[model samples]
Target: MMAGSGRDESGAGGVDDAVRELLLLMPRMVGRVKRIPVPEALQSQSLAPRHLSLLSCLLFDGPMSVNELAARLEVAPTTVSLMVADLSAKGILDRRADPADRRRRIVAIVPERHDAIAAWLAPGAAAWRRVLTPLAPAQRRLFVDTLRAYEAAVAEERREE
Candidate 1:
């Protein structure tokens, strides 16, 4: 494939074309996501980009202990604990003793705030569903793996510099 032109040996657009398209599309995608305003119920709460994944995990996967959240988030349990504490204090999240294991605390979005949180995050999730729904399972895996590989490569390059 021509590096900049994105044309393959058969003159069919190939890998280069995909890369070029992604490069252009990613920023616009991010901008559109960033412009998804926080719902009125959540506007006064102290939230940030870091909370998105944590909340997304709970929203999509249901409640779990801080350690479970840390593992899913790829962060230290202490970090998740701090975020849980902060969100709980803000009344955006709730912490309750896990029924199955009282020693463990399960973290979740406060029941009353669930709708607002879901409403705030639903658009992006819906957009992803629309794009990925037509793909076969393996194709979806490939797409997700490709993005992860790209992210790893970028991080590796940054670290070397």
Candidate 2:
């Protein structure tokens, strides 16, 4: 496949094309969204992309150990430790000794900051909603289903490796 193109041997070439287009567009789209100037209230404590990604992972997956986080992020353990410490100091993350293993530390999103993070994500969420609004309900459902299938396929491939 080309950098931004997908080849389809089957009859679902249009679906493959749409998926490929979305894959190509999403990174650029998110980069633009990330570059949107932060509001004055949030500017003083703006988050880097990595920080936001870590927070998102914690928010969605709940508490996790440094090693686990490193695996999920595909980063060095020391890198995750640094990030965890930085986020903890910033009050965006909280770290505690794991109950199951006192030797391990668990990091989780700060509950108090959930609203702030959600608010900061509102613009990007709204943009996606608006983009999907043009699609018919059935088409939207199919699109989401297709994406989920694609995600599962990718995960399966990773597991096999």
Candidate 3:
């Protein structure tokens, strides 16, 4: 029954609490940082955070329909549709009639703009690296492993649901 009790009690409670607190606060802290005013050059033609998130999803998951994107973003279809339309017009995304279903449109990142998207994401990427850089090699490995385990658990829960 309690197969993990010994391991869980071996100073793991403190580690679990620390991890939980970091998980709870990191998002809020990063969101606050993201909301701070951007430099003039960056602000002149910056994408909103929501748009960045949508782009990131498309970049990672490949092509997706408006409905699928809405589900992934947990937003209204109309909202994703509008965002897709904007990105399409900006040439960052390509929208075409889905081959499997002409009634639906599929959106994907434009190959030509991948570099631009990566450049746009550079600051956030660097910030994340900086945050992890202070950790020792072993701690870094443990942190990454823990995050992967957490992600796997979440995926399994979603599948069961």
Candidate 4:
């Protein structure tokens, strides 16, 4: 289902054409946007989006064992272990033996870098704020929900590939 105007037959065709245009332009637009400077603090950190995603997940959800993080990320436990170890070496994350289970390792962000990461993210955050500010509350909710749908669709496509 398309957002904005795909709810009824009268608007379905128009929304379809608009969606086609959007899909055609998105990759080109993203290619340019990807060049935006990483926040200076993150400039040399070499953190990919997925890496930061792991950090964000840890930060927001609190420390978790590697297998749990892998499940949350829909990736292999070994992949999570490697990524966590790398981040730990970089001093941006820490991994400790889970107190309740000696065999489990809990991973968490370093705490100090959260602010720095937020600073680096401010530009994109501000841009999103500016774009959403003019929308009505319900419209903003719809936009967010639609964007999540798109994100899921892209993730599913990647998984298939």
**Tens-digit lDDT track for model 2 on 37-93?**
654444666568787667667766789998988898877999999988887887778
Provide the overall lDDT of each model, using Cα atoms, as 2-decimal numbers: 0.90, 0.78, 0.78, 0.80
Best by TM-score: 1
lDDT of 1 at 115: 98
lDDT of model 2 at position 17: 64
Ten residues in sequence with the least summed lDDT for candidate 4: 1-10
Worst 10 residues of 3 by lDDT: 1-10
Q: Write the per-residue lDDT of candidate 4 for residues 47-146, one digit (tens) a residue.
A: 8877866876776688898888999887899999899888888888888888998887788877788777666556666788899999999999999799
TM-score of 4: 0.64
TM-score of each: 0.89, 0.57, 0.53, 0.64
Evaluate residue 128 in candidate 4 and report its C-alpha lDDT on the 0 to 100 scale.
Answer: 82
The numbered model that scores best in lDDT is 1
Q: Which digits, one per residue and each the tens of the lDDT, describe model 3 over residues 82-133?
A: 9988878767789999999899889998887776666666677688799899
In model 2, how large is the Cα lDDT of residue 86? 84
Worst 10 residues of 2 by lDDT: 1-10
Measured over all alpha carbons after superposition, the RMSD of each candidate to the real structure, in angstroms, is 2.7, 6.6, 7.6, 5.3
